[model samples]
Target: MPITARQLLQIFPNAGPVAGVFVPALNEAMARFKIEGRLRVASFLAQVGHESGQLRTVVENLNYSAEGLVKTWPNRFSRVSAAAVARKPEQIANIVYASRMGNGPAVTGDGWKYRGRGLIQVTGWVNYQACGSALGLDLLTKPELLEQPGYAALSAAWYWSKHGLNELSDAGHFLDIGSIINTGKTGTAPHGAAERKALYDRALQVLE
Candidate 1:
């Protein structure tokens, strides 16, 4: 069954103006990804809820404190280096995202340009290019388009489909789905794992 805007609002409550974009995308993605069951919808909603903060924003926030940098991106910043760039959103984005995930050096500006956006925080240049191509959007040149509500939801659905999350959802593997969305690098203790799971539980009640 296709989800209604009323149902989405029941769960999210604050989806606000994005409700128009979100509801249609949810139904379309669910069908395209073959997410037929209520469990599947619940699982997808849970992860997207956590990733997009209930559809509040599509862009990832790069405003980090020194401590946040150390905790969030230890591989990119040390205590001294993090303190130097603390609270600098753009600079921090350029530095932490530099030279990885198919991005060039800081001067290339691909880091900040291809920074996380969309409902599921799609990062990396290669991913943007691929997702854009799949969705018929020129995301490489206009990365900000992913921040728009329609593309934000569609891009997330595309990512979810690409990762075969529908099968995981069918199997009721909520944590596994979360791990995949978290970049396939965390365990039960992954950041926001608990919150994601909590959202899943809540979504089950609302969706079911």
Candidate 2:
């Protein structure tokens, strides 16, 4: 069943009017990606809800404080380096995301250009290229397109399906889903895991 705006709002009460705006797009994306059925839809919505901040934050916020940078990517930034780039979204992104995830050096600007965006936080050059190709959009040139309602939901669904999350949902591997979404790896404890599970449990009740 296509999820109703009411159901979405129930899952994300703070979503405000954007909840209705994304309903049709979400429904279409879920249908296209075969993210139907109660289990799949519930799981998909829970993750997307958490990732997007209830359909409000479609773009990744790179503005981090010095401590935040050190904590989030402890391996990447030292106190001195993080303090210099604190609150500098672009600079922080270029430096932290540089030379990884198919990004070029920070000087090349690929990291800032392809910073995480959309519902699923699609980051890096390769992901933009892949999601664009799958959705028939030139995301390399127009990476901000994912911030739009339709593309945000669609790209998120594409990522979910690509990672075989639908099957995981079917098997009730909800924790694995959170781990993959949060840490990009399975079996490890994910950040905000308790919150993700709470969202999932609430979503199941709503969808049921």
Candidate number of the best lDDT: 2
C-alpha lDDT of candidate 1 relative to the true structure: 0.84
Residue pairs with colliding backbones in model 2 are: none
TM-score of each: 0.92, 0.97
Model 1 stretches astray by more than 4 angstroms:
185-188
Candidate 2 residues 4-99, lDDT tens each?
999988988999999999999999999999999999998999898888888889888998999999998899999998999999999998998899
Q: Cα miss at 94, model 1 (Å)?
A: 0.8
CA lDDT, every model vs. true structure: 0.84, 0.92
Measured by TM-score, how close is model 2 to the native structure? 0.97
